[model samples]
Target: MGQGLSCATTQEHGLFSAMQSGDLDTVKAMLERDPSLTHQTTAYDRQSALHIAAANGRIEILSMLLERSVNPDVVNRHKQTPLMLAAMHGKIGCLKKLIEAGANILKFDSLNRRTCLHYAAYYGHSDCLQAVLSAAQSSPVAVSWGYARFVNIRDGRGAAPLHLAARQRRPQCVRILLDNGALVCASTGGYGCPGSTPLHLAARGGSLDCTRELLAWGADRLQRDASGRIPYLVALKHKHGACAALLNPSSAEPLVWPSPLKFISELNQEAKALLERALMDANREREKNILKGTAYSLPSPSHSDTGADDNISEASDTELCCICFEHVCTIEVQDCGHQMCAQCTLALCCHNKPNPTIACLNPPVCPFCRSAIVRLVVAKVKDCDDADQDIGEIGSPKMRKARKSRNFSSEGSSSFKGLSVMSPFGKMGGRGSGRMAAENEWVDKP
Candidate 1:
């Protein structure tokens, strides 16, 4: 009996080793020699060949094992399915295969009682996280548990996936989960701190990106945890000076995602990305102002992988914004066809902080024509020759001269729409003194 057990253990080790190293021929030969080897698991953890393949990103071996009628939902001793392992290790290929093979994304492990979605968010695997979320929309779990419940599903400690992602500093995962309807302000039971929201977790973790994401999704910075501490206090406690600067209740409010506008929801992906980047840039400028003299300093803005310098060169040929001549006109009022820079556009909309007590919020009006802004999109840059031709189409020499003079006068003063210009060293001398002066500052230009 002892000899037979020793031989079985040797075969199991070989099978697992073959799966881990992605040796397809050796796996096939071993499987052909012993058909039951496919079902064999490790003696201690009871991890099968499927678990090893998925964890190691051996998609070919995983596919072969699945095709051989092996259960994709096979759990190890910790009750962790191969799907969980795939997500935890960011094996997107294996994760997709398992999802297609009917693996359960809702299976909770024994460790934290976290599902594959939680594992994906916790491990900062954005691709795997998105895949699992996409699968959950059509999987049987969607019908049984409801999509919203699955998105905000809690673990043993009652921490939602958003809480985990924020605490782990997974900014992309946090954004993905928020876009897919994860509650931005859902509180946890015991994770990080009791009754802590995702924003609180982000603050405690000292992740400015994660905190910015949560705030853009309309997270309440003033919401306190069970211990009566807000996210600002949490950031200050952790000595995250930059984060604390942004979260300070007295500081100017950062812009939130423009979800209230119906047209914003209908924008194309490219247009949406441009607008989101613009919004983040505006907030970063505000944060810089708030942290001007502090010991903590923000890193320079990281440009997108798409060549930004090339875009900058292209932008130089475009028309300058009449509101802020420093920047190129990049945003367009779709309905009226008026153009402005992104900074001016954001200034028009984010003049006031959000008030949760108000049930109805008004849309911002276009600064040029005073018309309610119905739609906005990224202005497409025209070729240099085309722009020159368009410039020649102006009806009157006097009209062109008047427009040029207006732009020149507004060149250095970007204090449109109640945005007071700050001094280089954070001084506010000669600016409007009171709230009444600030409210009256947004006069229409001729």
Candidate 2:
């Protein structure tokens, strides 16, 4: 029995050697001499002559083996079928011959669970993927095979084909998967690293063209990964300023005020302060430019001011206080040509205080021309009493007494009775005593 087994083993080795060397005539002669040899296992790697023929792309030998009904589904110790070996080596003719002989197209390797399609995409072999896809289409298990091999197939680490393509910067593979309806937003199975949406991956990779393409395809810019970071912020964090700017232009402005004392509230303080400063400076510069004509530095006219020839010429030429949004009363112009009301201008300065630098206030621009305030306005409120009086007197005793008496019940006293007074002079203390005191004070003045 030992000698008989030795003879059988020797014959199998000879057939295996013939298959490996693509000696189809020798393989056919050996198989024909012993019909039982078709079912015989080979020595060495245990791969039969059919397995060797398919792997080496010997289409004629593979056909001859299949015609004899050699087990096409048989796998070696690695659980790789003959068809898998053919596909991996890009043996298109051998693969077609095996498929025609009814080889399983969707069989996965036992070690890696990788179907033939995975190998094709991994190697970037478009033709291989096409062949596998075509064979899979007509199979009885087509739907199951499609799902297992195409739709959600993931590696041991849960990385879909798209993830691999992205990490490798394989744009062509990415496009193929996208065309095949692969989910670009699928997350990998890991912790602390929320898997990226395809857009996030593109941005993180600094593939601007890919990023734009993903955006054009409706990728959400505001989508956050597992880390609470939007894609734009991620770009900024990575110092991709150009990408961040493209994603959100408003982020470029001084939207946040560093100090708390500048505004009434915390929320939107930066935005409000920025807008307020911009509007004030814009108005101030517009007035300064109008006053100085060609000599002043002016921002190019904005679209809103396009038809302003009538208004710019007809409008008052006096400089306006950029801070208060009022005409520059008691005008004080900074070296930067920005004008402000003298009082408003000085309020921005740190006179009679430590750290008297005008930089402390961080004004947006010049108070007069709305350019920029290089040196602070040191002027104070002039003609304070005249300005106050124009609005209304604050401390006149007659006015005070009249204001006080006007609130009193008219029925309470004889002093309040019959106090009918003219409208203009009525509230000034009813004409007699108030009028006489006023005249006396006027006579005493100057």
Candidate 3:
């Protein structure tokens, strides 16, 4: 027993000294003296000799040690494997060697629940990330299972690998995660900690490249977290001017090659596939509704009334919003001949405007037309709450106050009756006459 203990102590001292000096010869001699010395676990801070070699970036020592069949899977007192240390230290060559030797890519340090991938991502080590992912793909399914599960796995704080990459301002790492099916909007941590989505983290980290990658992966920048802060606001709060600028581009400018837009152009095959799926799902729903006769028909092009035809064509062509560039399935053509998409119009008219009126923004101009479009009527989604609100307030005190405030004629109560015109052009001629004209033209032509 005494001899064995003495031998173990000698092995530990010799190995630790060899690792510290990066003495490959001494390490080889010691390992030859006792083959078990390769597995003799003695870490200064609970890190094995492999961990020391990896952290120190001693590639020769690491290669020699790994050749002796030393378990590269050993973790330190902090549960950090050599791969994690190598990644953190930006030891790309050593990392590659270790990964090739079958190091655990998904090993998580107990301190932060951070994996080797997390360390590589957080430190902006693109080569390390590539090496780890490559090795994971080449290994047996059982060996790669941990990393496969970790793609969507969150830390104790619920932060996915994408979130860590974003938070660390690692644009390439963000791209890798997004390509590997990472969730862009997965929430992490809690309310006080903000429970930020990956977009939020990217914005906060001031990395426009990362933010763009997240957006290209279909992350919703407008979604508010538990604290009601969206990704753009998070960017502004964290002083990420470039990221915020990319997210909320100036309306006046045409947005020539914005960073987010540029980033989106680089989406990999998987991101494109995800987008295609979303678009296809939306199209499928639209087709189903059309078959059920619930879908609204578009105005036909057979109309001869030049003025009205021009208006309809212009409305149809410009119906798609510039913001999201999606077809404006629903619309609220304003009185000023300006036609805007439903969501933008609603946000402008009802939510942001002090007085909710058809002419709330510059005498009811069509958001698109910029003409003297009068308060014709609002076309809303079926069973829309806003439509209900418009109808329900006809005789309410609020309507009465609004009538008095707007100096509206109280003679026939037809003013309020026009509000019931649900069709797009129901009030075309008079106060609400345009509605009938537009609807009749649409219905009769089709």
Candidate 4:
């Protein structure tokens, strides 16, 4: 019996070794010689050949194992499926193969009671995360568990994937989860302290980008955890001055995505991106004001108005927003056709605080035409050569003034980047009143 046990252990070791090293021929030969080898697992962990291949990113080996009818959903000692291992290790190819082999995505591990989705988010493997989500869309999990429910699925500690992503400071993963409908303000039971929202976790983790994404998706900054601490307090506790500035409820309110509006929800991809960017930029402006004269400084903005592509066009052809006299007019008000810079448009919408009792606030009016703002779309800008024709039409003096601000870029943000010295609403114009008071004073009128 001892000799027999020794022989079996050696065989299992050889097979697992071949799979880990991606030795396709050796793995194939071993499997063929002893068909039971396909089902064999390591001694202690009970991790099978499939788990080894998937964890090590042996795509061809993984394919052969799957073809040999090795169960892709086979669990190890920890009850972690091959799919979970693939996701945890960020083996995208292996993960997809396991999914194709009908590996279960909803299988929870014994360690955390967390599914493959939670593993992906916890480890910050966005590609693996996306693959798992895409597979779940068509898999039986969607029907039995519901896609939204799976997205917000909790672990033993009641931490959702969004909670993991935020705690780990995975901005891209957080954004992906939020886009897939992970509850932004969903409270936890024990994860990251009881009743902590993703926002609270993000603050505790000191991730400005993650915090921004949550806030853009309408995360309530005022929501407190069981510890009776808001995200702002969490940021302060962690000494994340930049994140704390943005999370401060006393700071100017950032513009949300306005998802409640049917028209807004129906926007095209490009239009939606413009609006989201506008919202982020507007919030960054607020953060700048709060951090001014402080020890902390924000990192530079991601995208910029001035790029190699901008050099292809003449500055003269760009029509400046007459209201701001700063940025190029990018958003067009439909029917009326009045145009404004994204920042100005966002300012108009966010000028007044929405009543909490009301489900949806009335859409703001166009400052230019006094028309009810309806559908907004990306405006077509004139190409470089059309400069002389429309230069006067857009007001040459305003265009010239815009050039000055364009010459001064704020940490490589945009041609018209002036958040340090300007309000998001350009017309606010150093009104001496605080940002909140300045926003309150602005009246949309004909």
Candidate 5:
């Protein structure tokens, strides 16, 4: 009884020491005597020999434990497998060995529900996270559990790997996560880091590089969290002015966003729908006024026949629109009596592209007067054809309110780039506004 007890004690002490110091020879010899010892865990936390070798980055000892008989997925008291330890320490070589040995990369700790990816991300271990993601993508069995799942996997706090990486100021990890299909604008909901996105967390962490990476990847700068705070606002909240400066767009730098084409397409659709409706209404009003014959005032009778007279030609030249210099200036900007051809006015309101700089965008301004145009008036010419001439105009009643505090580049944006800024008011707008050439009389706007 005494002799067997001594041998067991010797074996236990030798195994613990060998595992602690990464003694390859002693570990090998002990395994030779009894391979079953490979499955045993220490008294504390139930960490096995594999856990020890992995935590210590012992490639050779780790390889033997993995190859001999150690369970790669064996859980400690905390429910973290050897893979989790390897990932936390950023043991790249040991991480690769365990992955090849078929370690469960998706295992999470019982306490925090954190996956190996989360551990790698929290520590900014881009290399380890990449390996786990690569393995999962390659495995045919991982089709349902692909990179999308791993990259976005959140812990108990509802924080995804990206959120952790961003909060920790891991720029490379942020780039990797974004490149691997991580949702850039995903918010940390109520349960976890509430109302914070990766960008928000990056801002809070005050890492300019991380903030730039998020922005470059198309993160919404104006995405509001639960507290109604945008990412840029969050940066300011934490007193990260440099980060906020980058987020703040300026006229000097050209604005480019992640989905420039998409934003443009959506805005154009909205402008077309609203403008078409306004145009349709204005046309009906124009036709109604025309039927009443108050639509136009008769001009003084001119010399009949093709005029070769210099005075007649000179009279025609005075009516030519200044902007186009070819068409008549039928519409005039409110307040500022600047005039342009109705056709040019329509095109101005219907411009489709974002003005590269918000400050330089002058959709609501009269090109000639440089004054804020409130509304537009289209004067009816006695002989002008309703079907041929542009008959519709835009209203700017709401422009002052929407434009005053507008940030066109913000996530929830408001722009009337292609839509005419002039609001149509039929004949009411004709009084004292832009005048029809020659008569200088206020006329019904089309």
Candidate 6:
């Protein structure tokens, strides 16, 4: 709300309606009779006709408003100028017109402290972002806010346009910001970031494409968050195995730094232990079957939940998902060994993206250890009743029937198949260094 808004009459409600409907002729005739109508604002939000025209991308109406020299920089209650509304709504044409009219590209929304480029990037408007970038070029005199200055400007959350685009899973916008020199690794630990890089955000978001784009643009894969998690760790904690696969140290070509030696040693130890356990379980089952003559019946063995209050889950369950304590634990997180029912795990991974359109945007994290879940293994624990029929040891690979499992070859995984249970961390996220356990760290234990 600015100059001439107070004195202008609002009795002509027809002007508002006409502009809203894009009735160009009606607006033209009314404006000819009373050229001052462009300066009047709506009674409620104090949004002038220019604001409405720009917000709705009324190109013809906007051109007419600019012709009258209506102040295009005027902001409404939220301190959102017309350019901000245009950028937020993906109204590229309106944005172009505003830039042509000398609207300040540097003015930010008062509430979020976001420049117009942040709005465009957050909403995934690549073209709108380009328009804002090209604004400094079209100006009469030179402006300080060039392509370099605008793309990297942080909001109240210290989130550059790149940060906004990365979190929102706008890969194209992210690329544009980076191409224009936006800092890819800027940290925003507090606000939306929760203390991680844009790559970390990309990992949590579960967009493999976005993660790749960030990585290709020099996003650090090994950079740690406040919790000492690299992007790969973040992905693992969140059950996005596919994401972890992209950044897993085991798969990538050698890094210049060779990573912390302790991680490698722990992974080796964890793999060895898992292989031993799985081999022992397999031998026990074979011996039991041979002694019982394959069909000889043995009495079912009864067992009770051990250490029910260990204050932790150790690849074990209580006949139920630990989170809900209701349904039988049918599914086990592959690497970390958290056993929860499929219903609970699926709900957790998909809560952020239930709809198919945005499903690929979010990767699920583990409910217990916050590790990225690479795979889910489904197998029934052997009960004494298995002696009555042809049964493999409860933990044997033959007894395991994988459902939705990507890789069952690792022994470190809850689902033992061709390989042993092993992880990057020695005992599922390290031997209790003030860290929650139960994440399979050795994704690659060949």
Clashing residue pairs found in predicted model 2: 337-369, 338-366, 338-367, 338-368, 338-369, 339-367, 339-368, 339-369, 366-372
lDDT of 5 at 201: 92
Which of the numbered candidates is closest to the native, going by highest TM-score?
A: 1
Q: Give the CA lDDT, 0 to 100, for residue 177 in model 4.
A: 96
| Candidate 2: RMSD to truth | 28.1
Candidates sorted on lDDT, descending: 1, 4, 5, 6, 3, 2
Clash counts for all predictions: 0, 9, 31, 0, 10, 31
Between candidates 1 and 5, name the one with more favorable TM-score: 1
Q: Which residue runs does candidate 1 get wrong by more than 4 Å?
A: 1-8, 303-318, 351-363, 368-374, 381-446
Supply the global lDDT for candidate 1: 0.74
* Model 6 per-residue lDDT tens digits across residues 57-99: 8999989888888898998767888998889889899999898
Write candidate 5's Cα lDDT for 1-446 as tens digits: 00011113445667857766778898888989998788776665677778777877888999987777577888877888889888988988998999899888878798788888888898998999899888878865367666577678878888999998998999988878876778878888643348788888998898866875676445766677888887777777888766665554330111112222222223344333333333333333332333334322223223321232233333344454444444445565545545555544543443212333342322344554344555555532222222222312212324322322222333322222322233323112222122122111111112
lDDT by residue for model 4 (1-446), tens:
01011113586887787776788899878877888888877776777778888888999988987887788889888899889888988999999988888888989888879899999999999999999999989989999999999999999999999999999999999989988878888999888789999999999999989998888777888999998999999999999988998888877666566555556756778777877787776667667777888887766578765552354335444455655556666677766656666766666654323234555656665554455677888754332454433322444545444543432322322323344245445444233111221222233221
lDDT for position 395 in model 4: 42
Which digits, one per residue and each the tens of the lDDT, describe model 2 over residues 1-446?
A: 01011113577878877777789889889888898876766553456666778777888888888887788888765677787777667788887777777887667776566666665555555565667666766785567646434644765556666655555445555655654556645666541246566656655656544543343333455667778777677677767544454344232111111121232122243333333343334333323333343332345445332243234322222222323333322333335322234323323321111221232334333322234334433222213243423111133444333423432422322322232221211222221111111222111111
Candidate 4 accuracy as lDDT:
0.74
lDDT of 1 by residue, 109-223 (tens): 8888999999999999999999999999999999999998999999999999999999999999999999888988889997878999999999989999998888876788899
| lDDT digits (tens) for residues 1-446 of candidate 3 | 00011122554877867776788888878777777766665534565778778877889999988887778888766788888888887999889888888786766678678788777877888888777777766666335465555576666577777778888888888877766556566788742246788888888778756765565445665677888888778888988655665555331111011112222234454433433333223223322333344232323323222333243433243333332333332333333222233333322221110221231123322333333333333432222233443321233444334423332332322322333323222223332111123222121110
Model 3 lDDT at residue 268: 50
Indicate the worst ten consecutive residues by lDDT in candidate 3: 251-260
Against the unseen true structure, what C-alpha lDDT does each candidate score? 0.74, 0.49, 0.55, 0.74, 0.60, 0.59
lDDT of 3: 0.55
Question: Scored by Cα lDDT, where does model 6 land?
Answer: 0.59
Q: Once model 5 is optimally superposed onto the true structure by TM-score, how far is the C-alpha of residue 32 displaced, in angstroms?
A: 2.4
